[model samples]
Target: MAGGSNTNNYGGDLSEVVRQLAVVAQQLARSSINNGDAQGKLFKKVAQSTPPTYQGELDPTILQNWLREFEKLFGAVGCLENSKVGCTTYYLKGEADLWWQQNEATIRALPGFNWTKFQDKVRDKFYPSFLLKQKAEEFSNLKMEEMSVTKYYTKFIELSRFAKESIAIEKAKARKFESGLTIDLQLKLCGQVFETLDEVYGRAAHLYALELKK
Candidate 1:
């Protein structure tokens, strides 16, 4: 987010998107003490309550890509700890769309992929351009099925939009079905977050990129 040449020339939403992302990562780290508390009960309830927030096989390759980019991006801050947390495919690639975003541009830019290494090697070439350079997964892939290799990677950033939003919708539905662990728990949790995390996701630039247009 600093000024000058390295200042995310993609402009507007991109830098803001990255900044908010950094804040999110930082906040989660800062609030881990309470975050763990919030998680312990909520997760158990969410899992057993009703509709599950998570479903389907998250792409391992994409998660690795996210972890690497996370390391590269947040590494500047020196806050990201426990390589296991960042390295795990589970958190990083919770949904398919998130994985797509971590490697969307490069996958689209190249004519074809080295399928064998496609999942792992993506970590090597990540850059700002990967997220900013526009590409669509729908048109990039040649296969008829929507999830085919070529098409799958193309729509990552755009799909990232979906992946992020899906969590809110799903979580809300879960809360409604599960009662959100009673009112007291909810308020206490909110209080913890208000005191801990830097910013809420919706207010984060990544959620409002269109409004921040340069």
Candidate 2:
């Protein structure tokens, strides 16, 4: 009968629609699983790097070193920008973990929160403004004096972090470093066209060695 033929055609169309929806659901499930697996792999890579733990140390140097270590590891592993705070916070223990837990919700609620913001927050919490100013002053007054070229260079590099803007550019860094060297060394390096701190350091070291021999 014609009526029976119409019912069969309608049922066939309904079944095909259901089948298409089922296929889409399956694809979505597979995509979700793949994404989860990739995230797990990335986290594992971060763990293998053995990132340092922060325990709410009051020492600015310790906090700065810990932050620097994480920065290095993040660069080495090619960590995702969105995931950096999560990864770094995982290494928090003791008082540091407690502080993060207490403030996590509020910090997360802020608009446009990211790694740099996180760094600023941590510094604000741990690094006092007066101490930072003092460190900057020490860097400004640093001089080679009797220190060997290598030792002076080491100190310069260490203190430079506190006064980043002073030597933000290569030429300024070279000039600032040269200004701290002994008068003899400065005279030797004067009127030269050094473009970088490293170039100035190399020439200074070579000159210092020659002076030691003489």
Candidate 3:
């Protein structure tokens, strides 16, 4: 049964959310593994056994990078026994997830940016968070020292809100495309991906709607 502290992973055990959420990605990769046995090893080698472009988004370079980072940032067991007083693993996980979320927001909030440029910005933001946590592991400042405590607190709260909201929206999109789940897990998975894109594009739709209302 799918269950966890829906109250939230307060202790930074992000694996629950990541595991539940990555059900789609994990299943697809697994399918490739299964096919490798049946269709010979050659076909199994290619992750995307098809042409890599649709509409305007190319596969496995930009969007795929963000997807993989999101999985790693949010979808793992975060535990660090770094005995640095209060340098808990929970804190590390929170920063990583928060980093993933801010980029998600930046990408979503861009109204007219090129997709490639948008992706580059996401990767750019990811590295800083990675470095901050690495520095924190060494009893150094988590970089919160650079800002006033109030500002740091506010930043944490803002990122926390974004991550939670984004995950909820993602889950809602997943549920929407769940109808054909029985026909084939692959199609159902594609449906979920498209559903997510719908939400991403819906932000623009919503803005245009508001402009019309005005």
Choose the strongest candidate by lDDT. Answer: 2
Highest TM-score against the true fold, candidate: 2
Cα lDDT tens digits for candidate 2, 1-214: 8999999999999999999999999999999999788778878998998878999887677889999998888898888898889889989899889989999999987899999999888888889988888889999999999999999999999889999998899999999999999999999987898899999999999999999999
Tell how far residue 92 is off in model 1, in angstroms.
16
How close is each model in CA RMSD to the real structure? 26.1, 3.1, 27.4
Error (Å) of candidate 2 at residue 157 is 2.1
lDDT winner between candidates 1 and 2: 2
Q: Write the per-residue lDDT of candidate 3 for residues 27-120, one digit (tens) a residue.
A: 8899998855544432232222321221222222333433444334322323122211121111223444465445555554666544345445
Q: Tell me model 2's lDDT, rounded to 2 decimals.
A: 0.91
Instruction: Report the error of model 2 at residue 207, Å.
Output: 1.9
Off by over 4 Å in 2: 1-25, 190-193, 212-214
Rank the candidate models, highest TM-score first.
2, 1, 3
lDDT (Cα atoms) of all candidates against the true structure: 0.38, 0.91, 0.39
**Against the hidden reference, what TM-scores do the models get?**
0.17, 0.78, 0.16
Per-residue CA lDDT of model 1 for 1-214, tens digit only, reads: 3565455566766978999999999988889967676555443433342321212233333434444554454344443233223222233234444655675566646654433234344333332234322322322321223232223224332344323433345443233212223333334335333221122222222323443363
Off by over 4 Å in 3: 1-96, 128-214
